[model samples]
Target: MPLPLPPLFAAWRQSLRAGYAWKSLRGDLSAGLTVGIIAIPLAMALAIAVGVAPQHGLYTVLVAAPLIALCGGSRFNVSGPTAAFVVILLPITQQFGLGGLLLCTLMAGLILIALGLLRAGRLIEFIPYPVTLGFTAGIGIVIATLQLKDLFGLSLAAQPHNYVEQLSLLLHSLPSLQVGDSLVAVVCLAVLVLWPRWVPRVPGHLAALAVGAGLALLLERAGLPVATLGERFSYHLDGIEYPGIPPFLPSLAWPWQLSGADGQPLQLSFELIRQLLAPAFAIAMLGAIESLLCAVVADGMTGSKHDPNGELIGQGIGNLVAPFFGGITATAAIARSAANVRAGACSPLAAIIHAGVVLIAILYLAPLFSYLPMAALAALLLIVAWNMSEARHVQHTLRIAPRSDVLVLLTCLILTVLFDMVLAVGVGLLLAAGLFIKRMSDLTDTAALPKHFHHALSDLPEHVLVYAIRGPLFFGAAEKALSVLRRLSPGVQVVIVDISAVPLLDMTALAALANVLRDYRAQGVGLVLSGPTAQVRLQLRRAGIQRVDGQLAYVRDLPQARVKALRWAGGSKT
Candidate 1:
């Protein structure tokens, strides 16, 4: 049902052609280590933001990063869990739990794989830039709002589904804030913000995470009020009280074993799987956009070209496999990719090594992760949301873009925040397509020939009239163009349509032309066509429309149409 992978795997192809040297290998190693450290906290943070265990994020990185590097076309793209998936994944988890997420991811992976095999990577650009901007801004706002409870260490008894309700709940619970938790969250937030600027060589999130974990331990030991991951999830390993995270390797997990929040067992029914299709499609679309955009940014930064279709296939394989290994959705993370490029990464080896390095950290450091404050993770998410909002881009678009485009942007933003990504994108695309059609229609025009052009004809005959059509004679503009025929002079005997400027025509345009021709035939006027381009010529001939008053004649140029019209008008005898 699907095509095979390209002739050669992208990473191997690059290695063969680019001459992977020891010098490049050295650069790849350095960049890989830097990005690996940088990627660690982000992976954990993104998973938590989506209401999953921190380890799920790490699982995604361990599984997806290396696979994408091996199969993907972009040498520098860093694939893993990202903030962009949070909005889409949150509702799915809340509704259907982890099982639904796994199944949805699997379905999305299949779709992406098909897209790549079909070489449809270039179709991703069809989404309007304004629509993406609007929805991304909306997701950012939603993410920030969702984190408010953790940001303030408020004891919200239950999380609300909608943004406004979540904010209301946060405000209501603010008085119940834990002082130590609040303080630790603020300190971690500050470190995450300033650490990169202060220590340029080290990854800031890891530093902030350490700061939060240390403060959390201090508060817990001192018997102050704080909520560590240990307090929420208790576990035992080797007769020790492991705080939160489970020590793990890449191991297969069954998707059907998922349970609901109320601890109800999962059922693999047809209706349930059918309901997930929309969300799965949304995930696929978001993944494609995020990954391709990351690759584009990588290309620009490194002055390297990436095969988008190959990259999509690679991402498909990563997502398709990760869910079985206790992981969630993933894509090419833009920040890490940019970091890899800046750190002198020469190939996908950097990304592969990054995955390996994170795996090593998982073996050694994951045990201590349970002592980290949940509020600290929430703080990291706040910074991520801030970056994703792109407030500067929104402000600039509003100031400079056309009013119609602004409307699309605002509509998409509102819909996304109030509804979901799928609905927002659907409505936004509809608006864009409608606007495009209207603009095209506006460009097409029809006009009767002015008096000065009569001399170019074989002989000036009063009953032979000419009309010129300009711009694309497609469905959108066809009706308007044909309406000009209604203004034909009463004594006109032959109608000559000069289609020299018409680039192409569709079925709707042909139907409209047929209607106009029938109306002219009712008035005893014959029609002569002129100067159809090769494609349009085929379409007109296939239409097989015959003139009722006289035989329909197709001409090579305007003068030939003039001669045909003269014959129809009895001009040779004159």
Candidate 2:
């Protein structure tokens, strides 16, 4: 049975005490504070990348981090805005605006909760390794491209949505690049690249942000033409204030009041919702993949087992709640989680503390964020892109993986770049599944033996046939077994199927066996099953094939099967 949803407050209380040791509390607090500092800039930068306000990113960290830590099974997982979600959410927000995007996130959260309730958390493990690599690499490319405009402060005539068009526009705008912005970006990039080597303990990205912000401020005072956060956005709470509550509330939104660019109500048509369903599903799938993958990484570092199902539920609840607060989609942040562990977090309480830190920053430090330059944020994301791409893994996959996997990898990469993440993952999964079925079918085989009579075998009767089954009997291999059974000669008094060598049988294989039995019985042949594995026997019994007349003669060994076959042949004669 599937596990029930855990009580949220109870989980929070449990998390506070989990992994508790007086020796580790001080270290955990230090680590939590360090991670909080690192996550602040990243959370804001990812929010910008997704076309949302920086505060929304802080909202995600505030709500998602603690909620996931409390309800999730992972000891050190910090959930919030991640680079992977940026690839998916940006297009959604671009196409549908923030309202529709919020609805999609809500739907995705519900889907994730359902998956957790259905105990489908382990399903993420089935995603092909190449497919993940391809989309990740493609996402990195997209993120890098998005950063270019900010990196150079290019003033394009228009921003394009597609990657190719975006690049073309960026190229066209190269002449408009501001020298001041370029200098700031270069400095930020340098600090991000070099600070880690020297300060090993301090986060280089945070240092880069500080340096870049200072440079931008200095340049602004010196009368250089560069953009700051204040130029791009203005915060207004009077228009439509979202309900503010603790992070434990379920995410909900009334779609009626949200408006589009035309000042009209947002589209709430069923068709639009239906169209958005695929994207929502894609978001949930990628969330599952990225979150669970991060959790696994945390497990390796912390030497703790994570409940994948519980984590999925927590993610679902976090996402479900976040959209109402004007937050975009979220997932486990691998970089942040690793930092939390390295900082010496002892338990989930450290994650909760990190969330508290972000909330404090959001409420008090909003204006200070206005001084942060877009170029510096871009540089920060550039580092994030580089890390997420895992170029070394990409090269390794190309060298060691099979041609088919490489083909899948390449296809997913191209589709993600040319179209969208939904299409890429869909096509990649289909291709992978098809190749797997083909491989399994290739490994499956069946053969029939002709009837033989031996005088030395006096115990044996005439008109008896024996057929042997080997290898896994699954959907891909069922056809071969059926074909062999169909080829059995007429007038055979007894047909014995020897299945001892068959290691597995799925629903399709069981159905094939039933059809063969029914066909042989109609042809006046006595059918005997022999030497089935324990699992195979249980399956047959469950499928109502345990009895043959008043006798149950399923055998456990070859010798017993041979003797049973002889008796069946003799009984037919009598």
Candidate 3:
């Protein structure tokens, strides 16, 4: 057999076929510049949130954005290091360092590629809404909480891994809050909240960060030092050191060659790969969900369709290539993608140009970025967390949603906050699946058919009983729906079961039916299966439930079944 064609660059090809005009290119340029300005502060802040140098985040956008745009299935999706990754990436960085984190990203990229090749992108839709909401809310809470140290300028001896412990540490260190940092954070936050209303044309984040950086510089001159990016982070080149981010393009290098948790080279081994497998899978799953959801949102905004599998492959390629360029796990940022659409993005060229904007910032504006206050970045992330949590939506859902859905939501939320996303998602899916099965089973029912419903059934022999089975006969519902057959009275000479309404019959249902047949044979009663749909009939015969002398019989409809039952009753030994 010939191999199937790969779903590569599907969106790019589609947009090309649609014909790009100069007008479209102009729109793309405008959108790219707009979103690029928005992404700069966000990327740095997310990298800081993940316990890495801010440059790595910029590197992610520099590499991943253009690659995803060139190869992905969504024309307007802007891929980058997003706030959603902080909860997962922070722990990895703490435990494994940059090298381990990058290696994990590489593994996740491969997994995503495999998922795309298997055509599993559409499966993301099966995840229940409550599950997504709960985990996101939990993640938002975690991200917001982690930013508190910087937001308050609290000095910590060490950061703990557990959420409760982290909270305790933050509370204990609250007395050490630097007034200068608090002032910077408050001013930056005010600007972020109000700038959009004051100047609707300009992005709030850029203005807020600019104001915060200026405030931090003034505070330092006033003998009240608030920590800035240049003060907290530095990089070495040749022999001299550069403050904040490095002003250069990302160079190629192996992920495993970077520093580990102990500030030494990470040892790449089978055991290490095994250890990272679970986290890698988690990254891949989350990336797939985030990217596909973003693509769907873009589709709704632009009235355009997306090729989901092609998008997955493109994301996989971006992630796979990014680690070598000092990038971390990246996905389509929803807010950025929304901003792209609102800024008049017309094609993948906009995303490609967004990458160009980031590249320009790295080369020209890198030194100035060092002046951005940590508190300002923290303040920015606080807003991100607020938007991400969707607290109002969660409240509405709790009020109006079914109790089972509420339970799933709360369970996922609590688990995610306390433990991790992997456990939360796994348990939530299993719980949802079990609840769904119970609900489906409740809908399947078997009951005696009333003779008055059909004129031909009205004169049926008193010794013959006809029952109708409805709904799919899957495992959960099979035994309960078919158990009625075992309760037939001893005086009953023949039982006609009408199953035309049944839409499916699984192995469990077949087994349940076989048990029913055996019980009827033992009771010396004839069984007539009537009105079975073609599928049900095939299942019945395949399970060896064929016509037997005076034991079992099959008929096409209720009328034929009535005749069969009457004839059986007449000749029955009972």
Candidate 4:
């Protein structure tokens, strides 16, 4: 047989083959601009949330967005810096600085590409819904909590690492809250919450930021202090210092050349890569899960199927190339993709155009963005955190889901908040697996033939008995399912085991059956395997179980096996 073709750039090819229409182009254009406007504030906010300059987030949009759009498997997937990474990235940025974070992103890109090549994308579907909800809810709490320092304008001497520490620090800093910043945050958050219902056509992020910036400006005129992006972050070019983001595109440079935690260039070596591997895996895992989940959502909205492996490869390529251009980690943003669908995007071109919009903003609107109040960005992220939490769904699941599922969910949530995502996911999966084994083991059974069957076997010997085995026989269930055979009556001279209903037989089950056969033989009893499926018969033969001299027998039907058993038991056969 010929080898199957690789799943690469399938989205682009399929979109073009569907025949582009002018109406489609118009929809794409509108959707692109609308989502792009939404993305500008979001990209910057997410980067700031990760403890980096806002320009790094814009660079992610400029590089990764177009690359993923052109090569991805979902036509409407919008890729950029996302809020989910805030929990994972912030710690990395604090300990290793921007350089380490970029290196970790690069490593994650390679891992994603490997996963695609290995065709492991379908495995992502097996992750339970409760687990995803748990971690996401936990992350939302973390992100919202992180925003508090800006939201309340609290001054912190140092940032803490864990959620509890961060919360404690925030509470302690409550005395230092700036009234002007708090006022701006409240106004922006209120607009963000109310504007979606008031003017659904306009993006809330844009309106909220505009109003918040205006409020901060008025406060500044009143001789009150409110932190703005320009005052907090700055860029340098041609030996001249400039406040806010630079009005230019990201240029190619090694990630290790960026500033480390000690304010020096990073030393790239095997030890550094090894130290970063764990976080890199975490980033790649989260990225793959988020991006694929986003694609599934897009598919549901548009009634289109996506090539998951192709999507992974696209995301890998985007991340692999983006780091050199000063971009941080990125993935498909669910909110932005949903907005794309609602705005009538029909192909990947809409996402690419969104990248162009970000590029334009970076070159021309950088200075204006510098004037945006940090409090306004905090408000935007607060809304994101609330939405990401999916509070109603969580509550519903807790109320209606199985107790074990609820346990898993809560465990994951607590672990994520107290420790980290990697540990939470690992423990949750193990717990889920153990519970699944118990459930499946309970489903498998070996039961005696019903009393009604005895009516048709009137001539059968009293020394013969029949039992049926059902369900898959694996390690978790094999011994329990076969325990009934071990309790056979002493007077029973022959036994028939019906395994036609069994669908699978693993080694553990085969071993158990072998032990049962050995015990039955020592008791001078005849064993008849009745109506075993072909596959089960193959397993019996491979395990050295076959017809012997009046000791063992295999029959194609249950009636034939009964007749044989009767003869062996010296009973009158029908």
Top candidate (TM-score) = 3
> Which is the better candidate, 3 or 4, if ranked by TM-score?
3
Worst 10 residues of 1 by lDDT: 545-554
Give the lDDT ranking, best first. Answer: 3, 4, 1, 2
Provide TM-scores for the models: 0.94, 0.84, 0.98, 0.97
lDDT of 4 by residue, 410-477 (tens): 98889988999889989988988999999999889988885467664555667888888888999999
- Candidate 1 achieves a global lDDT of 0.84
What lDDT does the true structure give each of the candidates? 0.84, 0.79, 0.91, 0.90
Descending-TM-score candidate ranking:
3, 4, 1, 2
Candidate with more favorable, higher TM-score: 2 or 3:
3
Cα misplacement distance, residue 183 of candidate 1 (Å): 2.8
lDDT-superior candidate, 2 or 3: 3
lDDT of 1 at 450: 66
Angstrom error of the Cα, residue 560, model 2: value is: 3.9
What is the number of backbone collisions in each predicted candidate, taken in the order shown?
0, 2, 0, 0
Better of 1 and 4 by lDDT: 4
lDDT, model 2, position 159: 53
Pairs of residues at least 3 apart in sequence or in different chains that clash in candidate 2? 251-320, 251-321
